[model samples]
Target: MTVSVLVPSSLTREAEDKREATRKLGYVARAAAVFRVDRLVVFPDSGAEGRWGDGFVETVLRYAATPPYLRKEAWGKRDELEYAGVLPPLRVASRTGSGSDDSGSLRQGIVTEVGSDGRVRVNCGLQHPISLPEPDEGLTEGERVSIRVSSRRPVRAKFVDESPPGFVVEASDLSTELSRDDAGVRIATSRHGEQLSVDRLGDIVADTAPRGTTVAFGAPERGLPEILGVAPPGGDEGGAETERERTDLPADEPDGSRFDLWLNAVPNQGSEVVRTEEAMFAVLACLSLTE
Candidate 1:
């Protein structure tokens, strides 16, 4: 599926930094905003369900000459977080609430580079390049935000940042949560929420086969040791959850579509891979459109 390239306000500062870095390096880093298709599920546009046919893949690869910054401030914070402190940390809840209550506005920009795994470097001009806003400080970083068309000048979005990414009303399907909203279908967590419109979502599926209805909470291949208790002593045999096992599709869908889409794009099976976020977006965009 294809994830649309969007320049959020969060990366403005990073874009400035990249520009400066490029200037120092004796060249301007041109950036363009573009989406990277991670998985294609139901793309009627072209190709099979599991892969982004050569044509679509080329389209994603050639969308922009340079990578645009499509990330948020919290990305840096999460990466830089050190496990040094052992004491109880100060926790701050937003009085403004999880959803945008004037927390801040996002500026847009372009991308500067596109890696093989679909990581694109975007460039947005943020005010300061100093300390980034901290997540625990009530400042949401590039946290997953679900933005939907509300009206001419207004957009509606829900800010969620606490629950895992799946609905667990029943004991059987605790692995994921899918929320249907005006924006389309959102597979999000209590913590990070991503918005996917119908068109964008459909594009992704037609391009990349999605593993199933539920996005990967954490793929089985990359399953962590302990959770609320999904795994047992020996845990999975690494490749236990086959491509077919991972999907929630009914019979009649194409073979290998669900497995390749979600497993490869969404989860990292210990390899140095591309950003799973991009893949997640592709599938989500499809679900949203279909819903």
Candidate 2:
């Protein structure tokens, strides 16, 4: 299933420094990679943005998701990437074995040249670019493609009609993101939302697993209700209330956001607060469960 994770641009609002901000973003990227998320979206939260805004968060997240070998080619020098050094690596599932194996290994490659003779030179993290017969559907230079390598000695490989591994980072507003054609089961995670119990999670997964899933997380301090200008259950300013106590508040009204459900993924938290990165891991872990 396609899984899209949404985090506010003010995700690092709690970070004290650039280094810590970058490190926190690394864990977010790692969580996305671990869950095999299809898209990592950064929604605007201008009010809560700290020193760095969406630009910094998007740049760091995109950099962290890109494979080390493809970083230089994918993104060149940029002023927004000054703190890139502090970004931790996301060891995503990509081609690991050398092309020596006969069974073939899946690898992502960028087209360097598309020859008239139906051949294209691809650089798939190899010592040298390899020339292979292009697929019937033509290819263009700078286009990313997937290839399966059968042998390294002679470099036997062929193009595979499949999506490349890892997720793509994007920046968009919450409304626009939810309006996408592929946007499915739009869930908003909050500490004051409906308590996600074991019995309820099954129905949630069943409903969302078919089309896809888009789960949104709030900032460290500001939650979705505040970000969206809606009064959270049991008032907007206070410590998190127990699930039983929250049920007594008024039901959630459509706050102009397209969220299908507001879920409290961590129902019985021992701590007073949950960081965005921590919430990402916890919420995704629960949603990723299968029947």
Candidate 3:
């Protein structure tokens, strides 16, 4: 079997955008390897117009040229995708105000460092200093601590205090620490999942940036199961241990070949591709079960 790369011109307009598109294509290629996909398609989308800083197609080629995870396989054909999906516009909202409450709140800050001592310092962009929360009842320094902060008003922030209250709990308390540096300051984003550095957006560090922005892109073929190094859903004895790997997703088709072929024709719920990615994913998942 052979593997292929797909690049939609619409996704890549500038040098950076083009590069990103290539990376996405490479990701798909890698996913294809995992799923053993043959005859991949490269479709270009020209949804982007004069807004592109540099030539979109050229930019995509530059970015795509970078070796992706699945670069091991050589891409074959190149085509144009008539319509994939309508990607929403990018909106960056300003952070202002100070007064805050529960109804309307969000966490804002700049991550300074991931401490070797197990403490994270964040500059909440507030005038006051917020205290760090106890990692866990038994959390010690050098241990990873997760924190979640939300903006109350514009400038004011309310740290989600998950710390177990000591005998003497107060109405107002700090959950994380902050410090000033040459670059500017450091602040915590959230502690529950991955500890993100809000100080840096994209690849560089900046003092002021939008609280957060969502980007729409194709989902990686290798998902949680692969990252965790687990086998597909069939309860493979040689797979890693994860809840998702053990569960079977609802499939639109049952027969392995027909289902897989059918799915390839649809786009996902969000994307307008003929066959939804979700359906294909569903079929792939069932195939994994049998594997």
lDDT of 1 by residue, 1-291 (tens): 222221111111222233332221111001111122222111122212122222322222222111123323322322111211221211211123345453333333333343444343333333322122222323222333321212223323222343211111111122221221111112221111122334444554544344333333332122211112222212222232333444334456443222222222233235443222334444344444443
The global Cα lDDT (0 to 1) of model 2 is 0.80
> What would the TM-score be for candidate 2 when compared with the true structure?
0.82
Q: After best superposition, candidate 2 residue 289: deviation in angstroms? A: 1.3
For model 2, the stretches where C-alpha displacement exceeds 4 angstroms are 95-103, 113-119, 133-141, 233-256
lDDT of each: 0.26, 0.80, 0.28
Query: Residue 106 deviation, candidate 2, in Å?
Result: 2.5
Runs in model 3 lying further than 4 Å from the true structure: 1-101, 108-120, 123-158, 161-291
Over 4 Å off, model 1 = 1-213, 217-225, 232-237, 240-291
True lDDT of residue 227, candidate 2:
85
- For each candidate, give its TM-score against the true structure: 0.20, 0.82, 0.22
